[model samples]
Target: MANELDGRVAVVTGGASGIGRGIVERFAAEGAKVVIADVQDELGEALASQAGPDALFHHTDVGDQEQIGELVATAVERFGALDVMVNNAGISSPLRRGLFTEDLTEFDRVMRVNLLSVMAGTRDAGRYMAEHGGGSIINLSSIGGIQAGGGVPVYRASKAAILHFTKCAAIELAHYDIRVNCIAPGNIPTPILQSSATGEDRERLERFEARIRAQMRDDRPLKRDGTPEDVAEAALYLATERSRYVTGIVLPVEGGTIAGKVMARKAGSEIPANGAPS
Candidate 1:
């Protein structure tokens, strides 16, 4: 049997590290010609090198429309066609220890990097993919989009917008055979989360961890932290012909996070708080 993505071409934004990097590697391993698009030149180039000849690195800041256009142009130039575009470029503001106000500038930056960047990449790459041939476009959303995020309001809002954008675009591009989808990831143990904590704030970070586990306890039916490969597997499904019938859907790569919510409520009822409840 042939590999799922054999001979296909894939473009992943922010492919230098974390979830995007994992997706790029998986796509490459499946035999897709991958493009690593990120602002981190050294790491991106290194990653591309390790991905083999089929992978190319382009220094891209998705917040810049011109750069995104160039990124698409580079992919087509190198690989001759674009088959899958994963808009995974994003960043979070510095995490707050507790309920703290965010800077107005940070809010703007979050919106630009998380939301508008996806819009730009999707618009350009979707058109390119449609024109070349029908392809898959995967937008990286977050579990926060569907739930409340107290620490990162802007990040939450931006991800929420991306989910809607994925839906709206899926409808518009269906005519062209370009399937658009979004993946909402659960609490994955990525550097993105670790970077938010400070060495001096160990207790604060521990509290944050407890809260995350609590949230996820009810949030996911599966009691565990997600991995980057988990999300990549979902991307593979969306990118390949395996899911040819699926389009414009938001797949929660959340390991029962979405599925286990109701069951968790029942579980909570059965195991009531020892000191406070009946």
Candidate 2:
């Protein structure tokens, strides 16, 4: 089989698990040397080993500029060159906590991890890619970025910033042939979602998850929730030559959820709350 990305070197932040892991796997399968950068030592190492010789694990805290720089350096040193950078490392605000009483520290943490880290990684990685001519930068945003999520004000703001930052980077780097794009995913059932749920938050989260599951299966037009693979495929397209002319665009991998609101009612099943069929 002809590998679309044969001989390429790709760096994926948060590559140890979730959507980032999927992107890393897809890239490696296409013959790219991958660097998995994450704070998760055990999982990162395990994933690297499973991905074969072309994969390297760099225990990195992406929010730290020094660590991000080192991550880029490691990729270039090991692979001879850098061709793609996926700024996929991120975190969400704790769930069941209303915005009013939310701690500022929690907000800062989310901002640093989800927003500032993308900025740092892209800046460092872009320097390398530009010096070598060009490459692709994929930033992870979310549906909540475009739409409002009631309780997570900080997360919403950070993601919204990510989308705009991607456009700005694209404009500035296009001259160097470096393409920057953002991927906005919706309702991906990842550990990140679960991590947002805590002991006190469990009941509310359970109900929320139930509502989401119902929407995914019978409420949405597609009748399904999106998987990590959906977002990975989008990243793959954006990273490869396939999107040579694509840049500065926020691509929604949200299964049409972003395009249209799917209420908990399909054509034949939307019964009125008043116990009457409309």
Candidate 3:
């Protein structure tokens, strides 16, 4: 799979950093022409430079539907076609005192960026793919969406919407050979966890982040920590023909955190006295 995406064209939203950046680099290495869309001008341009000529940086605010449209148009106009669309731009809602006291002030912005953006990207990209013989669209959700909990409730809701929206879009777009899938990543350390916090909530967010880091120490089924590259690998699978028949599914790259909590035990606790059970 050295060049699994050879001759393909891709557009990755929020490709300046974190998980998005990883996908951009990976896709480029796999021989795909990529458009890195993000509002972070400097970082985006720098990344494009590192990714070589096949990668282009486009200033895009995914919260603005118009910008999203322009992103797709630019990709096709510049690259000749759009084969893979990665909707990875998003923001985390601030932590409130509680759901009862939650003002839901960030509701509109969070929903617009996280949920609506995905819909628009899928539509704009799918429209071209539909007529261009179909392609793959990967939407980035989160483990928070699949496993409910407190804190960042709005952010979680927005991500949860993407899961269903992706599946629905998959069903509707299948006739055109387009495959739509969602990737829910968790336990991957990123600066996104600290975004959108205000005042005292900022301190709380730090503590919450610390708790997450502590939990990831060894609690999950997989002992090692996950990385942006881990999620990028999943994106690669969906982008290639290996997943030609796969669509409307949620792939979790969270070290099996969503499956169930791992019970802690001593290193040799599981071994029986006989030491073997053939």
Tens-digit lDDT string for candidate 2 (218-249): 53456567888889889989988999999999
Extract clashing residue pairs from model 3. Answer: none
What is the descending lDDT order?
A: 3, 2, 1
- Candidate 1 to truth, TM: 0.87
What's the lDDT for residue 111 in model 2?
Answer: 86
lDDT of 3 by residue, 145-175 (tens): 8999887899999999999999999999999
Which TM-score value belongs to model 2? 0.90
Top candidate on lDDT is 3
TM-score of candidate 3 against the unseen true structure? 0.94
Q: What would the TM-scores of all predictions be? A: 0.87, 0.90, 0.94
- Model 3: which ten-residue window has the lowest total lDDT? 194-203
In terms of lDDT, which candidate is stronger, 1 or 3? 3
Whole-model lDDT values for every prediction? 0.85, 0.87, 0.92
